[model samples]
Target: MVNTFQQHQHAALPRANHDERARQEFTKSLKQFVQQGLLPGLTPVYQTRAAKAFEKEHGKPPADRWDIRKAMVKDLYFQHYAATNRIAQELLWEAVIGSVERQLPELEKAIADLTASNPAPLESDPAFPVPRYVSALDIHCMPGGYASEIDGKDIAQGAIYDRGVYLYAMGYMGPDNDDMGRSVCNYVKRKMPGFQPKRILDMGCTVGHSTVPFKEQFPDAEVIGIDVGGPCVRYAHARSKALGHDVSFMQRSAEDTGFEAGSFDLVVSHILLHETSGQAMPRIFRECHRLLKPGGLMIHADLPPFDLMDPFTQFILDNETYYNNEPFWGAMRDKDQIGMARDAGFPAETIRFDTAPMAIMEFAGADTTYTEDAAEALAEREFTAGEYAPGGGWEVLIAQKAA
Candidate 1:
């Protein structure tokens, strides 16, 4: 077995420095305050205010979550929470970028050596068109988003994302920020014990954190990760190589990957759907269908759908759509994913949706118990209705091609 790249221990990485550590701590504390102090206290008050307003205006309680969200926007508490959250997010990235900028030359030299030690194949196309969904805005308030370069050979965006994501997630993604990939892989193993895929593909595999877990889970599979960002794939290749994994990292769009039809036995994505625009989703789903072999599985792990959660919870989650620069979040969440899969040519009966326990939560001593029978039972059960459980698990959509 190859040695896993323990991100926290990697000396060449940005987080190893004192400045980055302090920035991360500050970001973590800000996030905790927003999540623990502001959100919990403000939600009920906002709901009550919205409820009374709705009754006074329409002679009844708010019709749905959308109405509540609309009303909450006018609430002072909600506005304060939203503004504070945005400031915290922006400040987090500022600190990360500042730290990287301070030692760009040294960090550049360091990554060159780290990536050179065990080089994996990296393919990038200068002629490749950058999608509007990616290029339009600075998603997550990052200065240049994921596809920008400071200079001709800059990897600053990649480095910033790699180091800052853990802090952004407040360590919920574990020390490596790879729980999304690990959780999905674990679900596949328990649900399909006999299914051994020979080839695997991860779409939108930024920095390849999500890509490496597949290699760890199915060591013999030929793994390939593709993204539109050149720096992301480059950093991913270097990270994979440094970690002793032999996965190929390529710069390509998920909506139209250049791979041949039926080339992969399994295709997966982690938190990629919401990042894409509504117009791009159908094409991406079709691409996944076109890429998978007969009977091959395709799974997408992401945030829970809007309908599955209460109005308040939905309102809270929708904050990303407005403040975090993820404009497509609401549109994607409102989508019927299974319906989209069917439109992409998969049979209706083959599509499945279920929530899986997060790998990091499980590893961190949260309830890790999940058997095939238990998964099946959860699949049969309806979506739980109440306050959304934070750090509980992830929602997954699984589809299989016809044999």
Candidate 2:
């Protein structure tokens, strides 16, 4: 099938001119080709040649992903596959950066105006110290990390991310790139039918792509999205306003958000844990527990543990740690998250891992690309390492405090 995917336009998103649009489209197509056409070859290449070669060089065949990695890295096919994947990622960000930079002044003004008119709170602290994990390197090779601001009020990083994610995901995340949050919300609604939260907190909500869905799901709830990146939260506020959601956005770290104890009925994060360090992960769980009220829910939607997948799949997913700027990508999966939740004060019986079925089918008629057949196929497809979100659903770590 010709990839008919296209990102739906929004006011806060950056506009791309003809040439820029072509470049962005090319990057997206290249990524699709990498995932659909090229990604599968690694398995055959590894099984047939790479593994045999390793056996010849050493005594035994590869025993684990580490051993498999040692074998595959030397093969020409793996080299080409890895290089093309990295190039696609680098191009994906570059394609969006120019559009954002050119429209910086206009984008900033528009965001400022949108945020000013929105009744919800938008808070930022210039004195807040950005964690070294974020500042260490430009994550995902995006030139400036999420926190970078121009004149202490930049929105370029957020705009770039907003546009870039569509290309990066090949439009699999729906028009707004909010599939993860939407999936989790659907899970909550389906699993606990009567659980309507009064206050919702989204931790590490960069640009609020995943945050706005909660407010949409629970209109009566007070939804708030917090992030350490000032630009991210600023853009999130404007984006939420532009999307017609009254959600608060604040510059705050997930490790120790200064919210009062038991202030929120629901505290969640989407793909945020993998980005944080080993030390930060446990603390974030504790913070989530602290922020949540008695009988409240805490959910983190992220990649499943390394132990769940085969060695080869783990090897494929580990490529993010080496190629992409995701420092904790591989390591985070190794951490015992259920145990961490227990340590964070959640009872052992209350914590478990669950699959939140992808809400893609709900978007069937929302966009041309999201046809019923296509959405169903995406939702039912098997999980492949290195693809965007899992085919079946988002893996969510869920816990509820004792009433």
Candidate 3:
């Protein structure tokens, strides 16, 4: 069976201009330098300094990550490291947004034409309200966050995210930033070889980077991607179309997708929980439950919970909660996702947590196959103490509703 919907080689649309390309490269390199060179060298010195300071003051080593964070804030080395990383993060989005702003009219026209002619459907509501959590600040310092629009038909937010995320991820998300979905799909195939979903839903699917891969993996399934951001869905629909993947992109809140109950067989979200408010997360989970059919699977891919990480690593990861305007990351990381799922009506015994190796280098003709044992091995890999490895892989929380 030749699947016409099979995705071709990954590619970026509205090709970056020379300046944009240069900026993206610079951002990528800067991020790599910060993560690999600067952070690794400074962490030990900062830790030692912080521990000594804590002992001197409290007659003990730092009792917890909070104590370490408080002491480290006073240390010059930690201060410099945090400041440098934050500045680089801001500059990355600035570069991408600057490039996009310069070509806004052309990019908008291109997206408009592409989406209009594309077979994949796009539905957006002008009346859709941007949640206060999203509107409060520019998450990750991306100007205007994900919902902003300009000139009534703007795709700038999507363009910025699409371009900036590659640099943000430092290529760990594969060529087209679809590794989260691909990794989750691989895990599902290995874990439940006999289970096949007829309908798949991706929530908070920005620009469809994490949405299209499901169509690639389950070519016959009806794949739909939804986000609260209109500009995001608009661009996502166009991007999926451009990539020759069949998908439906809609502007809708995950908490209330307006779909009939039990309408889907699989519901997934990639790195979305951390961006949602504490008050809204349970509702979102409940909505996932409501949307899925009997025996349907709900899978969420995100960073490992703080309980699975060392205190120092937790402190390091929580920096985004304070500095990067991602207010809910700390709360989300502290959440017991299994408990939350159970509260949302999924059976406790049906919930599972695991990790999946990212398909970072696989999409470009590398062998993408995995055995069941290999998947289990990846999931069971012991957590290394004291390292904050975000995007090193995906931590998946999965649940199945009672049949």
| Cα lDDT computed for each candidate against the true fold | 0.78, 0.87, 0.79
TM-scores, all models, native as reference: 0.89, 0.93, 0.89
Q: Write the per-residue lDDT of candidate 2 for residues 178-295, one digit (tens) a residue.
A: 8788878878887898999999999999999889889888999999999999889989999999888879999999998999999999999999999989999999999988888999
Best by TM-score: 2
Model 3 clash count equals 0
The predictions' CA RMSDs to the true structure, in order, are: 6.9, 4.5, 7.0
Q: Model 3 over residues 1-403: C-alpha lDDT tens digits?
A: 0001111222335466788678777877787778877778656865667778878998878877788787788888777778888888998998888777887777777777778777877898766798999878899888889998855466788988887887787755555667788777877776787888999999999899889888877889999999999889988988887777768999999988999999999999999989988888999999999999999999999878898978888888888887888888888988878899999999989998887655542322233344444334322321222222333457899999999
Candidate scoring better on lDDT of 2 and 3: 2
For model 3, give the 10-residue run with minimal summed lDDT.
Answer: 1-10
The per-residue C-alpha lDDT of model 3 at residue 285 equals 96
Compute the lDDT of residue 106 as modeled in candidate 1. 84
Write down the worst ten-residue block by lDDT for model 2: 381-390
TM-score of predicted model 2? 0.93
Candidate 3 residue-wise lDDT at 136: 81
The residue ranges of model 1 lying beyond 4 angstroms of the native Cα positions read: 1-7, 150-152, 367-391
